[model samples]
Target: MAAAYEELDRDSFAALTLDRLARRSGVHVSTIRRRWRTVEGVVVELLAERSSMLPTPDTGDFRRDLTQLTQAIADFNNALRNRNVLQGLLAAAAHDPRVEEIVRAAFVRRIEEVTLIARQAVERGEIPEDTDPREVIAALAAPLYYRVLILRGSIDERLVHTTVETTYQATVAGVFVRKESREGNRKGDREG
Candidate 1:
């Protein structure tokens, strides 16, 4: 299937049929059909595989831990074929919202893995208990997205340092605290 995908890089998924993937993978067409209901399913699984390239590691250093994760993301986007595949996915997504949603959701789900860091930070009192994991995780990834997708800039050591530092500082400043929690804190202060 990967061979077929490499061959069909510039071509549409319609070019990838069960027979074609079977020939490329040397797997039986019936098995392929049973495992993957459609070409879209095969693509989704491939995207999932790519998305999971970054793992959530706990090095006992909160800032360093997230920096490593973001660095992995940067490296993945830096690969030429991966970038091309992403652009192709985006083009396909323009006409197919389902594909867009699936890919987006898969990436988001992967991002959620970093939420463990946030949780650990809260437990260690490194950050406020009300800090939202989703916000912190989003902050960690947004700069990488901007660098790779929007600005087309390169991700270097400085960018990685700044990204981690900025998120860490923001978290400490309560920038990621939930709105309701902030409101309640204000009320508590007034009462006190």
Candidate 2:
């Protein structure tokens, strides 16, 4: 099925059929139909499968960790197959509630998995104790997605470097510190 997607243009996912997928995967059409029901369903599953391949770095240095994570994201988006899978699923999610739900769930899972990187940075005293891990990760990733999905551009080394550097600077400056933390800090400042 992935091969079939790779063989076509990025926007050709809509033309995909169960028969094509079955032939590509060497699975019976009945089995494919019973399992996935539709090409969108199969793509949703592929998104889940491929998105999970990103590795969370535990290099113990916050900057290094961010660099590694950003590079991993770059590598993932750099692949035509993975990018097509994401592009197809996201385009489908715009009109299909089921696809939207699955896509959202898949991203939420990835966020949760990568949040540990930020949490570890906190433990190492590299970031603020009250830093919101989710926000941190989101800040780090939003630009890459924008470049790929919005700009329809490819990931380059310069973007990766800027992403890591900016996110790291913002995080260290308490840009992603939780609202509660910000409020408390303000209160403490006033009292002092």
Candidate 3:
């Protein structure tokens, strides 16, 4: 069903019904319903499975690991079919609340996975202990999204490196870390 969905554009995906999926997959609607509960359930699970496959690099060097992850995503987005599907989904998400939920949920899931890098970095003293992992993950991903979706620009080599370095610089400068949290960490260190 997920592979079936991948072959579709936004409209086609939105048009998919349990019967259509059942017919296409050779599974009965009752089976799909019993297993997935709803169309949204199947799609959301598909999105989760899709994102879970995204690389989570851990080289013990936060910068390198982040660079690898971002670069891998960029490279994936560089492919025409994948990019078209993503763009179509983004466009579809605008009007459909169900689609929007799936898109946002998938993003949050990816954020949760990627944020582990930022958390690990704290233990390594690469990022501040008070740094918000979500913020760091956003910084790493935002520029590529902007380039692809907004500017319609190339997700090129330089853009990839710059995104990684800029996120790293901002992180070390405590841009993603709350000021009060950083202060509290300092206080704890001093007291200890």
Residues 1-192 of candidate 3: C-alpha lDDT, one tens digit per residue? 554464444344556578777877888889999998876667666656666778799999998998899888897777654565566667667867888888897898789888889989999998777788888899899999999899977699999989999999999998888655665645443212
Query: Candidate 2 on 1-192: residue-level lDDT in tens?
Result: 564555444446766778777777788989988978888888887777777777889988998988999999898888877787788788889988998999999898899899998999999899997888888889999999999999999989999999999999999999988775677755433212
Report model 1's TM-score to 2 decimal places: 0.78
Question: Could you tell me every candidate's TM-score relative to the true structure?
Answer: 0.78, 0.90, 0.76
Q: Output the number of the TM-score-best candidate.
A: 2
Error of 3 at 54 (Å): 1.2
Best by lDDT: 2
* Preferred candidate (lDDT higher): 1 or 2: 2
Clashes of each: 0, 0, 0
TM-score of 3: 0.76
- Residue 147 shift from truth in candidate 2, angstroms: 0.3
Q: What value of lDDT does candidate 2 attain over all alpha carbons?
A: 0.83
Candidate 1: Cα lDDT at 20? 77
lDDT of 1: 0.76
Give a tens-digit lDDT track for model 1, residues 21-98. 787788888888898775666777777787776688688777777778878878877765566556556766787898
Number of the candidate with higher TM-score, 1 or 3 = 1
